[model samples]
Target chain A: MHVFYQPDNKKHFLETDEAHHCIKVLRARPGDELVVTDGRGGVSKGTIVSINPKRVEYQVRDFYQVPLPDYRIHMAICPTRKAERNEWMVEKMTELGVHKIQFVISEHTHRETMKRVLNPERLIRVALSAMKQSQQFHLPEFAYFLNLDTYLGQVEAKERYIAYVASEDIPRHLIQQLSPVRPVEILIGPEGDFSTAEIEAAQAADFKPVSLGDTRLRTETAAVVACHSAVLAQIQ
Target chain B: MHVFYQPDNKKHFLETDEAHHCIKVLRARPGDELVVTDGRGGVSKGTIVSINPKRVEYQVRDFYQVPLPDYRIHMAICPTRKAERNEWMVEKMTELGVHKIQFVISEHTHRETMKRVLNPERLIRVALSAMKQSQQFHLPEFAYFLNLDTYLGQVEAKERYIAYVASEDIPRHLIQQLSPVRPVEILIGPEGDFSTAEIEAAQAADFKPVSLGDTRLRTETAAVVACHSAVLAQIQ
Candidate 1:
């Protein structure tokens, strides 16, 4: 079933983008059945009542709720220098299921790179499309780009880990360190990796140091691995 | 340390591309030390002896080998309709460590998509870059695209699995099904998924049906998840 996002349960109208996809793209007609989610766990089966080029209104025939997962996954990553990589990461992370995503800046993030443009709206659209594609009801919340310390200060989770390539002592693998059914957050650094001071601040903030695997993963790959590891850890 | 690929340990010259990257991109001096890998486990530290724009010759100062992982992961996937997605999958799988990657064409693969141009050379370049970037000594071998039945017949592994979305009973999750320290091969279907006949052929070939996770994943995401799961399972 093709699912559409309609964030407001009370509003029968689909948003402009969703409406365009439905009416202009899919050519959905009046009386056609539609599956819609408010993306807050509310899913409704509805029939299209009316359609304008920009407006699609539906009448709900049945409503149900998808129970939220027992554990939450929040991924904080240093946005890659390339926009496509960041977009790809967001898309995959959504498909793998994340509760929140935040872009962080560390000492190693170059000033020119910091000035690089990001289209949050585009990322949100990618996430929404991924959520629907993956049959997920909850859209991941996006946090603004933050400094590493600032982001760590407001951190709230049952467990947190920073993926770092330590020069000295080897850290435990993230898979082994993960406890089942616990809300977890993971931090993935930029191509240059997190500075020593950033790692120390994260440690002070109570984040454990964990390695994803033997290979040195790209920032995006590390994020996906962390997300999937968290999802798999929750299964048992 | 910048790493270069010199597949032939006996040959002191870097490959053309690696030479260009080293000389043109990094502008390394003649005496600068370089880390080079044969990609079959041999890693050597060398000092540049001569530099021509297209040819770089080095003297081996120290030679070492990275021991192979106890287990192997082979991923066979249906190439995504989009070339970028396929390239991305190859890059990530190499970074995450795959012994072999085979592209399969199934019944549902459209003739048009089959004719869709794929640049194998470019993909190999991506894989090489990823192997160097991830600091892995093993480069994944790529098999030519084959028919599903032909591919199924050639499979040899301690364990094999096909990620499928069944309409009936839920299959065992891949993570739970994996046995530690065993060579494993996994197959990921196209966007439309494996047809019933393809799934049956795999089952007949002793490929167990397994689910990656609850959420639906794209062809590329499923491939990465399978690759990572195999890597994680081998840790024990």
Candidate 2:
């Protein structure tokens, strides 16, 4: 049985696209056993009742509910110009586990990104694929369409930090500062780094600036490191 | 002037390609100050002596000695078919700091990689670029061209770990297991993962199996996690 994602299945039916994949690509037929997830930590083992080119109906044989992790990640990163890297970030973080992602549009964000809009659909697709790949069911929500003020306004975290390279201040490394607290948000800047003014503003906004480590990491690498650090901090 | 890599500089002259970047791209002139690194913990600041189409001659003004971290990373990873990700592994690990990389051609290693030989120069080039990008001054040695017996025969590590997923025999997370010990080697397998026989052989050879958190990470992600964990564990 192949695994597929069907986030909402109150009707217990696979959509046309997924039905097409099951029937045509996977050669699935009626009475075949299938496993699917609802991306909200709900996985079900089902037997197909009927199938057509457009849809497949199934009856749930059993369901497994996964409890959410004790901690949540609210990773806010400025979009890099290379959408692929941003997609990679989404995929990897979703695999590692995250609750939400906010695309921070900053003044120093790559000029190349300014030429085009960030695609939320593509990020969702990447997230879904990674979720399936890692055998995780939770899909981290995107907060990209929101502006900085609205995004910050919506974040209700127990801990908040902004990752940036500090000069004389010498920000503490992220791992050193983590306390395994629930609901954490960490801001990662772009290639040129967050401007001094942006850092000050974030500081005023109560974002504690932290460094991932001694090495200067790329934006995507920093995001993943921060995400993993938060996850590890909560584990033990 | 712009920074460039000249790996073999015993003759004290930049090669044609680097010279082109220096003279043509950067328009560096005689008597101009320039920074170049030998990629082996040697960073030298020099003054241009002369330039030609073939090479740019420089006299070393000063040399910066980067102390090899009190630790070393002996990362042996099964190469994935996607060479881009392998290049990415080289770049990210180099940025984060590692002493060496070994390509373990294992039984479950992707068959596609077996068809094409590992490219050491390309890996080094990516490493050099990452070194400069991260402002590091050391290049990690590669052991892909060597036979496994000869490679493992030279093991001088204080600690050894094999990163893999286990079901019955629980494995400690890599971070929880690291002790800041010097000369640690961690093996990461391919997508198919190491076989039970291979695991047993490693266990017989004194390799402790370890997990990198709860997520089922990609081969590259696992290797990077192992690399970063080793580095962070070493940092006081």
Candidate 3:
């Protein structure tokens, strides 16, 4: 069954936006069954009861409340202007099962400011689309924008890591290094990378330096890789 | 310094195509120093000797032959139609240090008749570009198109594996399961995936089943992930 996303579940009726999509775009009609996810672990199975060009209604047949993962993997990264790169990262990371995404501004980040065109809503939509496509139950939280230092200080993960290409002797053990005792917050820098002072500041705040691999990965690719590495470590 | 590819070292001269790029596009002048790689293990430092638009020449200043990695990772993947997707996979897998790339035709592969348009040359160029960008010493071997079962049966690797999403009893240990073999071959299917019979045939040919991650990744993403996982395992 095709699944739709409706974050708000107050009305017990499909909103006009999703309704038009179901009726007009998908040609969904009365008696057709589909699933709707509330983006908060609530999934509802519904059969279309009313269908119109403007509005479509469905009656709930069954519901399942799936619990979110215990470990929250929050990746705070600098956004790349190329929408496709950022979109690719979002899709792949969602499939890898990240708990949240926070786009932040760093000292050497390429794009200082964006039009907020691809806001949290659109990112959440992408996450939902990937989630449904990948048969995943949880949806990651999305945030608009934040400064690196400010966001870093706000996050309260039991274990924090900063993934960077360091010339020094960093911990090579990816799986064993990360502590699975609590949630993880991993900060991935942009192409120019985190400045020296930024790295020092993070280290001062107890963020361990972890290596993804030997290769020099793009900002978006590194983010996805780090997210996957963390997920694999925790699950293992 | 701008780098250009010269696949044939015996010529000891830049080809007309690359000469045009060096003199016209890059505006390189005589006495300018740059690095050139033969896309093998040959790395050379050269100084521009002539700035002629048609036949620019570079005098070799110094040369170094880097040793290849102990372990060889060859990935035989079904090429995707979107050139960018295949190009991205080639670049990322090269950066992650893949040794060989073989484009194969699978049973359910969309592009059944491999067109000459999607040649391995472009993929090779992308890999070389990625190698130069990542400052890697050795360039991967580029293999031509091949049929699935025929190619799988011909290559004899110390260790061989196929990434299949459906197998439940497959080992989750990615790099840990493999022996420290010299050469490894990994087969990645197309977007539609290999048919059931194809999987059985591979199993019969002594290919072990391996899982990349828990998520259902796209073709290119899966290839890169497998490349990284296998390379990291060898490094460990």
Top model number, TM-score: 1
Interface RMSD of 2: 1.4
DockQ for all candidate structures vs. native: 0.85, 0.62, 0.46
- The global Cα lDDT (0 to 1) of model 2 is 0.79
Candidate number that wins on lDDT, 2 or 3: 2
Report the C-alpha displacement of residue A123, candidate 3, in angstroms.
3.5
Tens digits of lDDT, candidate 3, A1-236:
45677776544466666776787778887888888888778888878888767666778888889887677889988877667778778887888788888887878654434434345666767787788766676788887567777887888896888887653786665555776646999888876778888889888888888887766777787887788777666645
Please state the error at residue A233 of candidate 2 in Å.
Answer: 0.7
Candidate 2 ranges with C-alpha deviation above 4 Å: A15-32, A49-57, A110-117, A145-154, B23-32, B49-55, B110-112, B115-117, B145-154
lDDT over C-alpha atoms for residue A91 of model 3:
84
lDDT of 1 by residue, A1-236 (tens): 78999888888879688999999889999999999999899999989999987999899999999998889999998888898998999999999999999888888776457446457889889999999999999999998668887899888895999997754777888888999887898998888888888888998999998988888888889999999999989875
- Predicted structure with the largest lDDT when compared to the true one: 1
DockQ of 3: 0.46
State the DockQ, from 0 to 1, for candidate 2: 0.62
| Each prediction's TM-score versus the true structure | 0.96, 0.91, 0.86
Expressed as tens digits, the lDDT of each residue in B1-236 for candidate 2 is 24677886565789867788788878888998888888877778888899988799999878876788777888988887777888888888888888889887777664456446357778877887788777777788887743334445566785888987654767888788887757898888777887787777776677888878777888888888788888778654
Backbone clash pairs for candidate 2 read none
- Chain B TM-score for each model? 0.94, 0.89, 0.88
Candidate 3: segments with Cα more than 4 A from true spot: A9-33, A46-57, A110-122, A166-173, B1-3, B10-32, B49-56, B112-119, B168-173
The per-model lDDT (C-alpha) reads 0.88, 0.79, 0.76
Interface C-alpha RMSD per candidate, 1 decimal: 0.8, 1.4, 2.1
